[model samples]
Target: MWKSGAACSATRVGVATIITTVFGMALADALIKQSSTAMTLWQIYVLRSALVLPILLVMARGRMNTGRYGWIALRSLALVLMYLGIYAAIPWLELSVVAAALYTSPLFIAGLSAIVLREPITSRHWLGILIGFAGVLLIVRPAASGFKPLALVPVGAAFLYAVAAVITRAKCSDMPTRALAVWLNLSLLVTGLAASLYLSRTGVGAGFDYPFLFGAWRPMSGRDGWVIVVLACLMIGISLGLARAYQSPRPQVIATFDYSFLIFATFWGFVFFGDIPDRLTLLGMGLIMLAGVIVLTAGTPEPTRLEKAKVARDQPLVPCRVKTRTRPQRTDTSPSNR
Candidate 1:
């Protein structure tokens, strides 16, 4: 039938979209890590977002209307926290390690969906959650010797990301994806500005460790400026790609393809940084990835486009019946699922 053919085509588009989006994201992570020694995280946040927000405004083209500014700002803050957690650990952990640890967002999403969204989570979903946590443990190896607590930072980042996704569906669902991105960049800009000011004024980072995070801004070369520009472009691309993928009729397909981020992260790590994952790390990454696939694809439904923010990027789930009202079925952007 025409419907079936159309479904398959849409699924393909979603798959391609998510794969490309995460590829750019993974590459951006590598670039940031590579540039960490040259630029502070605050500096890059200020410069990269400062460069991108104008272009995004231009692209938005006078369609900057929204009624849920408060919720949107909160969602953006959650993402900013997620961003901080992931990036702050970069100087300490390997790329693959951070990537694997951050992928734990789906498990957090699963749990949060049950608690906050009141969504239906099947037995299989619970199994996936357990497996995902096991993978996280393997990656973090808390019981092992010489363990750094920073390894758990990305795990916490995953939780923040889940909160953002939930807020997207619960409150900011009426906004546009472009607007969501613009607000996120704005928040990043504000955060960078605030952090820079505090650090400069307080002189905390003057003698403290973690120069990339809390230290004062460093001088940039022409090459460094161009690298920041490239990062901005990648951010725009990933944001738009994520929107496109999630807006496709078959968003679940898109969510499934997001797992490619693990592979891309590992590839870039090896090729660019010459960093390789040890056997346990590799196994842990595999488990985390497998858990995500299961969490996303299991107990699912045919998905549709999300509101302004799309998350839960790799899976779809159905909500349980509520006595109060009938809820329109919407897929998570990683439901609100990717």
Candidate 2:
């Protein structure tokens, strides 16, 4: 009874942690979008990490996963590209649109895992894939009179993120999670420095309107600096919170609440930018969420009658594994799946 009570408590904690983490993530997205005029993408990448990387380093103990550095770099590059797509679209797309589009990542992971990992996918998983894309089409609205190209950016980002997930599973499965995060932040820092250098040297975006992407380094106001600090906090908060949440005995519960980011994104969008997703966008979000749940449960097996009989006769505990397209899987339970 005590064990069951503890499990219930742990589940509650996981649920709360995941929801809180995603809320912070959504707020970070909204903040980044709001601060676009003040801070460029590269600047935020550099400055934000400059602040948070130190603490993450202390936590990770400066481990580099040296043996798998090549694979780690590849994964980090994929994720950096994914973030670039996500943040670049923020200035142009609605927050909810970006969230929903990026949330299509589960579908991409499902498809990619089948192709790359050679994992057998269940029929329900395929149905999930189809339903997820249907949601994408509704959100993208390619045939509509007012389709925007930026709407596709998050979808592309989602695919890139899926690629990173596949790499982590196939190659970096043994790397410590915090250590991997260290490299990711380091990659972001290096990329930011390189881009800032090139832009500053060539004046490539001189007098252009894409201040968020192309603008060179500019002096930071106090408010701008604080935004950077807040964004960094959000980044670290998300990482730590996810780590804590997934550590819960009830990962299935944590996984279900993970989609709360979409709702939180929509909420922050409404509050910060007065951005409201229309009916189709909301529908797309719902389909994507439902598809994710279906995909998450796709490969879980029901115990056979013999196993059930044994359980009843002996009253023995049974163990089961649930697979997510790239979400942890049977042996891997890294939070980076999303």
TM-score of each: 0.87, 0.86
Cα shift from native, residue 3, model 1 (Å) = 2.4
Candidate 1 residue spans exceeding 4 A from truth:
300-338
lDDT of 1 by residue, 262-289 (tens): 9999999998889988898988888888
lDDT of 2: 0.90
Model 1 lowest lDDT segment of ten: 300-309
Looking at candidate 2, what is the lDDT of residue 321?
Answer: 78
Q: Pick the candidate with the highest TM-score.
A: 1
CA lDDT for candidate 1: 0.88
Residue 224 Cα positional deviation in candidate 2, in Å, after optimal superposition: 0.7
